[model samples]
Target: MPGQENMTDVTVIRGNVYERLSHVIDPEIGRSVTDLGMIVAIDVAPSHSTEGVRAPGRFDVTVHVELTVPGCPLTQTIQDRIDEAVASYPGLELVPHIEVGAMDADKLTGLVSSLKAERRENPFNKPGIKTRIFAIASGKGGVGKSSVSANLAATFSALGYDTAAIDADIYGFSLPGLFGVHSQPTNLNGMLMPVTAWGVKLISIGMFAGADRAILWRGPRLQRSLEQFLSDVWWGQPDVLLLDLAPGTGDMAISVAQALPNAELVVVTTPQPSASDVAVRSGLVALQVPLKVRGVVENMSYFDHAGERLRIFGEGGGTRVSDRLTDALGYDVPLLASLPLEPDIREVGESGRPAVLDSDGSLADTPLASSFTALARRLIG
Candidate 1:
């Protein structure tokens, strides 16, 4: 009688197993393996009644998983998640047996085709999309615009926002080096997957090799590069998108405004007067386009030494920029933050990590980290 009930339970579990596994998403594709036709077969049978092998009425679930390609980088991770899902089935003792294989050429092609058809156009361009786009700009180079973009992206991700960044500084891209992403993106058909590092999805020209770079860099114009990044890649509608724009107030800013009409500008400047003057001009570009000037960030504003806050780069450059922009644009542009000029900022950044974030991708407790966290919150709010 007990064995008969166990059989009924197993019958119900067959459908339940597939439902449970549907939640396991492939990190690269951002879709469930079950939806992608990766789970080829799931055979469920009664476990042997042998002593000490498994509890009575237990079932052995053998799951056949077919990957999109052989030698996939995340093969082990996918296998482990499948095992956990089966082994921890609720109210039953389920022993999981997973078989891994690659999808046949025809099946793989069909899957890729289905995805491309479903996502034919840029998801962000659609109406009523809730993604907040931030364009980091500076009037001139050496004002630490890229550093602010990188750290701000890291901070947004660490705070649990789905974040993505574009190294729009195409001619002088540095996000690949800053994020330390040496590996190439996974190319599924013509759509490329962004490399996730420090919890932020990133795409940069530096990540591509000779031929691959050339294909993406077709047309050799600033606006074209930004268009390719937006349309060609599978961005999956991130909650926050940050762009590290090229310095000196012209083509790139106009391109971003034209492309992303809702984008807000965040100006970065130093405490020095030379940098502040240029920085104000950078934010003033908002007047020409429909872009909103969000706020200003002052980098290299001070140096902390032996319990003393030293104004190494002079003071009030951030306020000056913000005040000038407010008067010119007739809108109050506030000074969001003033970051310190610590040696670790450069050293850690060069080592391929955002200094405001810890090694484990959490916000650090230092002043710099706090500054970024606050700035991110204010910008989003």
Candidate 2:
């Protein structure tokens, strides 16, 4: 009779249970279960005892859950969250009976439609929005533009600022690998979720595969892909969005300028004249578009050897690019940082983590991290 008693008690307290479940958020979507229409129904019933009678102080609380997708990778996480939510009810002895199922086509379609409608256009381009967009560009390949982008993004996230990144280098995408993200973005209806790694939300063409990559790669190669990355993926209004642009002074920069009018340009160049010369040209793309040249980052400026800073790639490339961009853009395009060439940057990056961040995704207290932290602060400030 304990089951009957507990069941009877839960029936009266089911409203309170619903309220508690409302606080349980769907981690992937960042929305509460109730808000996402995940909690379809709850049935409170008595547990049968061996004697064919209701067990005393025992109840089977069956929670009907309609997930957005069947076989979702995060399904167990959601279920665990729901179990925790149910167990949190004070002074109640209840066994959770979670019945998981996918949302019906019509309901899923409606939910996606509602979310899309609420989002409207790209949140970054909206007036008074707070996201700071920085497209990291280089004139030539091998200037460490992607490295700078990945590290800067990790630094931002480590500093407690919400950050996101895009591997806008469609042909030479690298963020996914740098961030060690092998998982694909979750597709909620037609909308794609950005994969979160290194405490930063990220999306890249590299995260897509076969038909998915083809679907996302639809439309004109350059602009449309950038636009889709902007318009299609759910970025959630990150405080900073970094784009590791393709190494060139061409279409990607123009596409970024058009898609994200508020985006600033952060040109990445080596300390060598050859790299800096092209780096300057890359920043010059701002002149062609209405984009602001934020600053210049001089990577591989030096190699530290026994307290001596060795300028392996030659010096002053950052300054030259900064000076050129300032004059051409008529703005204060300062040289933000001169990051030393470190082998660990490549080694750790190859291992699928940003060099600026420790294993815990926090900024390591090394010189490299400090440099990136300062760079991030300067850009934000």
Candidate 3:
């Protein structure tokens, strides 16, 4: 019985074992066990005390884990890893029983929200400089938030303004792919450096995600990942910092509200009245965060079919949202820009270039560029 320990001693040792489990990293997110809040409970048999350990210590330990979804694909892996970790502990002779349970989506979202709220201060607000933070947001998915942000960043930099863009859509990140870059940010003394393209600095989790593999990403991890993007990135003090936020009033948007207090909210929407209606809600949600509603940019507003308007998505959406913002946001948020149904805007975005930089094309005559330039001046002033 070289390793046998007393019953009371074994119980005390189980408590120590639980504390050690905090060091295990979640395979998917690379965060230590404690951040996940995975451990639901711990049980040690009666008779426990580090100082009161007698000979012949009983061997017993149990660990409970809460999963985010049912039939968690990594259940076996997590169990085995925990078992191994426990086995390696000295004076612990038995593998602790691992209890697995799933947490509902709402509970997961709350945990993620709290994770983001923990980092309320703007980590990049360095001393002695002026920087404007702009969060490009939308009322719904597919409103072109990422595309608009990329063009704005590139356009700003092309005009000699030092600019950076953070892909704040942690789960639906589309910035890195938009730039045609596949490299991950390197950690330099813990500060991650952003990938540079078109004279604009960029950081995105997309660069770290593998395209061949996908998973159902849930709450706290999403917020923590976005937080890392803000806290760890070597974002230079620039004239402006653009954030490509995920669509809707979700955790990532809330993270923006908590982290970037000085940032202005720029909502993106379409011209359809229905689209405008939903877009208005996004601004209303921003008001909940106490975000200043800057203005709205209507993209793909309409298609010019031989002078007669096609009105594909519907009419007056941008105007509708603009008017609603005046009443709801308590400010006159003008219709900032109306990008007509120009394929070149999509082409440039797909090609990792902003439409504003497309020369010798119909896009050169489009209304997006002029509006963007004017918007920039208004922002700086």
C-alpha RMSD of each candidate structure in angstroms: 2.8, 3.5, 16.8
Instruction: Please name the candidate that would achieve the greatest TM-score relative to the true structure.
Output: 1
Off by over 4 Å in 3: 1-121, 126-129, 209-212, 215-219, 305-310, 359-366
**TM per candidate:** 0.91, 0.87, 0.63
Q: For residues 1-381, could you state the per-residue lDDT of candidate 1 as single tens digits?
A: 756976777778888999999998887777888999999889888887656454565889999999988887778889888888888898888999999999888988898788767766666667888899999999999988899999999999999998999998876788988898888877766777889899889998778775234333323376777887887787876899999998977677888888898888999999989999988889888888999998999999898899898998899999999999999999889999888887867899999999998888788989899888989999999
Q: Global CA lDDT of candidate 3, please? A: 0.72
1 versus 2: better TM-score goes to = 1
Global Cα lDDT for candidate 2? 0.86
Rank order (by lDDT, best first): 1, 2, 3
Candidate 2 lDDT tens digits, 1-381: 645855567667677778888998876667899999999998877678878887766667789999998988778989998898877667766778799999999999998898888778676878789898998999999988898999999999999988899999887888888999989999988798888887889998888775234333423677888888888887776889999998987777788888888988988999888888888888888778889988999999899999998999899999999998899888899999999898989999999999998887777889898889889999999
- As a whole number from 0 to 100, the lDDT of residue 199 in candidate 2 is 82
> What lDDT does the true structure give each of the candidates?
0.86, 0.86, 0.72
